[model samples]
Target: MKNLVIIGGTMGVGKTATCRELQKCLPRNVFLDGDWCWDMHPFVVTEETVRMVESNIAHLLTGFLDCSEFDNVIFCWVLHEQRILDNLLSRVNHGGFAIHTFSLVSDEAALSERLSRDIAAGKRDPAVIERSLARLPLYGELDTVKIDVTDISAAAAATRIKDFLAA
Candidate 1:
């Protein structure tokens, strides 16, 4: 059976970095970033755009799931709400896949530090700090396994996920 690893976290919370590391650690895996679906020039966020991005993400992930070469599909996105997670999962075909959901979380201090560093490096916008911190609490409400990454490296977080799956 294949493995579908769904990772969710706030912006600048290491979801992308950890998933990238996870993709490297796992053989025969394809990594999908949901942000890529809505990576437009204007970066608009309307109801229609939201629906479009969700549809696009589901389509791309479903394609990967149907492919025969990949044994694992690693997806990372800002899946803060249980409703969003349920909606996405409902659209996918999980015939032979074991789904593992995880939410990466950290304290306000660690999150602020990370976002500040990213902003200084021009990797993210200044507004990301406020938005990310606001969403941080929502992860605790999710039904997925929570991984505290307050003081952990992305590679170490990836190892924990890999080990959890192995067990």
Candidate 2:
């Protein structure tokens, strides 16, 4: 069976970590970080870049959908709103797979600590951290599987996703 899993949340909430853990459960999978497509320095997100990014995600998903070796195709990004989710997903091929989406979440303090670590490691911009934290309430508004990583391991969150899929 083919499965497309889209993990979304505010930055520093452990979306990528959970996705990586999910890979352990379903190793024969194709995983793509959506930011890998268009996160570049001198970042200027105009309408054109947004369109290009959506197209790029669509192209990658279509390729993964065609690859039978992958039992699961996973993509994780900060899709803070339903419109953004719909915009990118509509571009995908929808290759007859059951698509599961989950939103990772955490308290502001935990999120702050995570982002601060990322900032210290120089893996993330300080501005992005502020912006992401400001959007915490927006994440809670999403209508999808919600996993709070404030007190749980990424593996535990992945286990919950697996259990949900099993049921």
Candidate 3:
């Protein structure tokens, strides 16, 4: 059975870098960025629109799990609530796949700094960063491993994840 790894965290928390490292470590794994789903859609993203988007994502995940093309799947998303995690797990429950989760967190000041950098780089909007930071605390007791990326390099963070998975 293929293993499914989900990396959830706040924006600028090194998810993309982690995904790249995971890809290198587990070469057979297929990587999917959850943000790409939003980018693909052509609708205004209000609260209601976001809910609809998640619903559609749930359906797409179902299809991915049903297909037997990939040996392992590494999915990255900003999972802010346990309910969202539950919904994702429920959809991928079939396949005898071990579900592993990794959450990246940092201090508020550190996050704000990162947000400011991203804003200056035109990588993210200030409003989006504000909203994401506001929802950060909603990610209930993370059942899986948590990595604080406050002062670590992306390579170091990736090594941590690789070690965790190997262990």
Candidate 4:
């Protein structure tokens, strides 16, 4: 059976990193980062753009799901709202696929520290700290298995997720 693992978290919460690690842990895995769909110049957010990006994401994810070479499809994004998750899931054809959703969460201190490091390294903007912190609580409201990644490495988090899938 195909495994469709959806991972959501705030910016700088290591969703990309964890998914990258998970790709290695899972057999015949493919990884997709939702940010790739909207990585446009002067990133604009409107109803049209949102719809377009959602369509694009759904297209790519559906392609991955339909492919025969991969048994595990891992997708990660800053999915802070349940509506967004619902919309994405609705768009994708997940029949016969075991869907596992996860929300990577952390305390404020840990989140701030991680974002600060990213900011200092020029990997992320400083403004992401506050924005990420604000969305931290929103993950709790999502209907997903919560994984506290405050003190764990990305590989460790990936291992935990793999173990969950194995069980």
Candidate 5:
């Protein structure tokens, strides 16, 4: 069976760096980022829009499953709710893949600093930071392997995840 690893976290938490390292370590895996979905239009969230996004994700996974090119998948997203995680997992489960999730977390101060830096770099909007921080608490759950990246570099964070997955 294919191994479907979902990396969930707030902005500036090194999800992309982790996935990059994971892809190198597990060469047979394919990596995906949620930002790629932003182009679908109407970036604002709504019940109908959320359903549509989920359907699109399901379709993407279906295509991956049909192809024998990759042995595993590394999917990264800012998954702030249990329902979103559950839905993603359900779709991959139907494709006969074993699933695992890793959620990166940091203290409020650390997150705020990261957001400020991102804003200065012109890579993020203030509203996006605000919303991400506001939803941080909603992501607290026992099922996820939460990694604190407060004082770590992206490479170090990636190494940590690689070690954790190996264990």
Candidate 6:
């Protein structure tokens, strides 16, 4: 059976790290980070930018879905709203794939600490961290499964996802 796993969360929530760890547990899979598609210089977020990034993600996923070599396709992104999630799913060609979607959750204090560490290490901008933190509430309102990342390692979170897909 073909499986499409979409993982969403706020910045510094270990989405990418979990994806990397998740890769070790699943065979014959393709993984894509949505942020990688937004690698534009001086990132702009106009209507055009949103549409383009969504289209890009859809296009990349469409390719993976069509490929015969992969049975699992893992997508990691920050999907904080229902409309955004609906808009993204609308662009994809499911082709009868079984989809398991989840949102990684974290407490405010843990989130703040993670972002602070990232900022101190020069890995993330203060403004970006602020924007990401502001979206945490939206994540809780989503319909998908929520995996709390507080007090857990990325690898452990990945294991949880793998177990979820198996069930």
For candidate 3, the lDDT comes to 0.76
**Model 5 Cα lDDT, one tens digit per residue, 1-167:** 67767789987767887788777777577887876764565468888877777877767766776678887777888887888888776775365666678888888888888888888999888886777788777667736888788888767766776676667
> In candidate 6, what residue range of length 10 has the lowest lDDT sum?
124-133
lDDT of 4 by residue, 1-167 (tens): 89999999999899999999998889999999999999998989999999999999999999999999999999999999999999999999968799999999999999999999988999888889988999999999999999999999999999999999999
Alpha carbon deviation, residue 152, candidate 6 (Å): 0.4
The per-prediction CA RMSD against the true structure, in angstroms, equals: 0.7, 1.2, 2.5, 0.7, 2.1, 1.0
Per-residue lDDT, model 5, residue 138, is 65
* lDDT for each candidate structure: 0.95, 0.88, 0.76, 0.95, 0.76, 0.91
Which structure is stronger by lDDT: 2 or 5?
Answer: 2
Error of 6 at 39 (Å): 0.6
Off by over 4 Å in 5: 40-42, 93-96
Q: What TM-score quantifies how close candidate 5 is to the native fold?
A: 0.86
Count of steric clashes across candidates, in order: 0, 0, 0, 0, 0, 0
What's the TM for model 3? 0.84
Please, what are the lDDT tens digits per residue for candidate 3 over residues 28-63?
A: 677878887778435477888777767766776666
Q: What TM-score does structure 2 among the candidates reach?
A: 0.94
Q: How much is the lDDT of residue 7 in candidate 5?
A: 84
For model 1, how does the per-residue alpha-carbon lDDT over 1-167 read when each residue is reduced to its tens digit?
79999999999899999999998899899999999897998889999999999999999999999999999999999999999999999999879899999999999999999999999999999999999999999999999999999999999999999998998
What is the C-alpha local distance difference test score of candidate 2?
Answer: 0.88
RMSD of candidate 1 to the truth, in angstroms, is 0.7
